[model samples]
Target: MFQSTKQTAQTANLTAGGHALPADWLGRIVLIWSGYAVSMFAGNAASYAGIWYATETTGSPLSLALLYVLAFLPMGLLSPFGGVVADKLNRKVIIVVCDALMALTSLALAAWTFIAGPSFAAVALYCAAFGFVSGFRTPAYNATMPLLVPECHLVRINSMDTLLGSISMIAGPALGILLYTSFGLQYVLILGGFGAAAAGVTMLLAVIPRDHGAHEQAGAWASLKEGASTLASQRGLLVLTIGVSLGMLAYGPIDSLMPLMVYDHFGGDGFAASLVAAVMGAGLLVGSVILMAVNPRRKLARIIVVSAFVVGTGALIAGLIPKGGYWAFVVCIGVLAIACAWFNAPLMTLLQKNIPDEKLGRVMGLFTAMNGLAIPAGTALGGLIAEVTGTPLFFQIDGVFILLLAVSIAISKSVRKLDAASSDHPTVEQTL
Candidate 1:
């Protein structure tokens, strides 16, 4: 039987590490997440529109590849510093200011596109700028989670966050196309601006708790090294991070290659590609909902390993689909997306449970930076490979690489030991 909302809230308050939660903590989280979701939806819409613009304008694989590289590279470079700032500053202020900047950026892009007409340069510039700002926002926002929610509800809230992102993925492309075809790119950008503004305002209205202690005593370089040492001190976590980073290096290009796969391999149009993306989003939504309902608190590492195998299998199958098998490809995409959701939620829960609150921002920032670097490198490599062998063959290679990576992780004693202990009561060593 499921506990009622009131009972769940009361239990959460009672078990919150000897700290009593505010009476309306749940409500506050809901309000903040809701606003963030709106921002994500609009931002995604604008992003897709920009992607489509690039696709139609250049029709080159390298252009698509460069888009992701430009978007993520700055964030990758800046995230460590961003993490240090997150640990040392007011997180709420960071989020609000970043959101406001994003809103203004969007509005400015809209105006520029309206005047100069759409260009790849403009899209690239926007991607670069957005990525830069997100470097600061991502670590701060992620670190704030443990402060707001109790340990027991961490998985649920993380799942909910991913679920909301899935929803944005499902709708963003559709809305982007509609607005792009009907009004113009300017309108899409304008909508994104409004959504970002709304997020900032809602965050302003909500009350968020501060970090347990001040981190301003340490210098920036020292703080960064401390965060890095903290992560390295945990053998299992260090191994896990390295493994995931390698996997992402192989898997990251899939996002950039999807439209090309649909167009070049399946002879499909923009709408078909969007349909496939939407199906993938649905798969993510299903996975997140299941995780939210079940709230599994144990064997998180095992879950990630199994999910990786499923994802690899799905990708392999998708790559093997025959021409005129677009629906089959879509089905495979959905399956992999579900597996991805499962993989992500558990990984995040494990980190949140194991890392102390004070250092979480820096650690997450470092993690994000690694991923950010790996993704662009992968995308660039994948683009070069796709140009020679076609997208289908690239997908097969990616899948095989991931499968091997997963097998390696599964056999490793260190990673498997991650699931041996109860995460509810992490030891001092684990937190350090």
Candidate 2:
């Protein structure tokens, strides 16, 4: 499963080349990270503009629902294949190609919208293409992590990811709104295209190893089956996957409805939505910083379970707040956001450490696919429940359900035994 504390320390002392890491290891990663940050920020900006445009133009729930489906469905459907591609192809090439393709498609959409005027179809098409590429891009990107850094630095690096994402969430939407209002959706789309393209070009400078095992003769179905088997081979990983997948059901509604909750329950305005998001982003940044500094190496299973419980507690408190308690709701959201880093970063590090590099892409792809599917299903279920009961009731029930799930994971002998199962095992090493 995972390396013991001692083994991790031993591995951390060696670089991907089995020699000591250069003094500039952190600097090298930062160089790569800067490119990603720019690209993601621009992508988020485009997405926000599209959503806002659709809301203003169509005002149809059906159209909005379609946009949501398009956003997630491609990833859900194509992730397995993407995972196979990641495992068998040069990951750097895959990343660059995905970024380039996405940029081109976005540019084409911008042209179409500029010529024909904004249409739901154009936005939906862009979202679909972007999502499709992301299915592949995300797996490769994640799989590349172990290649770039020592095992001990995984937590800190992943936390950096969380921190960047938080900054994007806080800044992207506001920037998108401003650009859209001042200029237009076309400009926003062009901005996104350039951003992605720049990232692709910049990524070319990074030196990454090719996948040697990818040449093995295997059909797509065979590759998928192999990936599935790899995941099933590890009981702790299997359980962890299932637990987190189910947990997405609890998260879907919260993600899709958070703005609505603020607007309806707390009598929030447009600024209030941004305010809540900023608070949550700040909380995530703080949590990420703490994890980066602490870099917890022991009792990961316990941390995951406990963080999940904290998340549930935050949700429960949010739901229980009296009407007009805006500040209280914000605090709960902050707590939920902070707990999110704890719940996710550790599990991600564990998977990266334990899984073989060749199989990492497939495993990450499967995880993304499962979680992607769960989100839309959960969103629909949560929406229906909210309609029947209330938003507050939905949050409360989701919290309780998550708490139960966490307790189940905590009490499981398999999960509890994970810590002791940690051993010094030889792992295939690669680098970027």
User: Judged by lDDT, which candidate is best?
Assistant: 1
What lDDT is reached at residue 60 by model 1?
77
lDDT of 2 at 11: 68
What's every prediction's RMSD, in angstroms? 4.3, 4.3
Clashes of 2: 0
Q: Model 1: which ten-residue window has the lowest total lDDT?
A: 423-432
Q: Candidate 1: deviation at residue 58, Å?
A: 1.5
Prediction 2 global C-alpha lDDT = 0.78
Q: Write the per-residue lDDT of candidate 2 for residues 151-171, one digit (tens) a residue.
A: 767778888888887787778
Task: TM-score each candidate.
Answer: 0.93, 0.89
Q: What lDDT does candidate 2 reach at residue 330?
A: 90
The segments of candidate 2 whose C-alpha lies over 4 angstroms from its true place after superposition are 1-10, 13-25, 53-66, 423-432
The lowest-lDDT stretch of 10 consecutive residues in candidate 2 is: 423-432
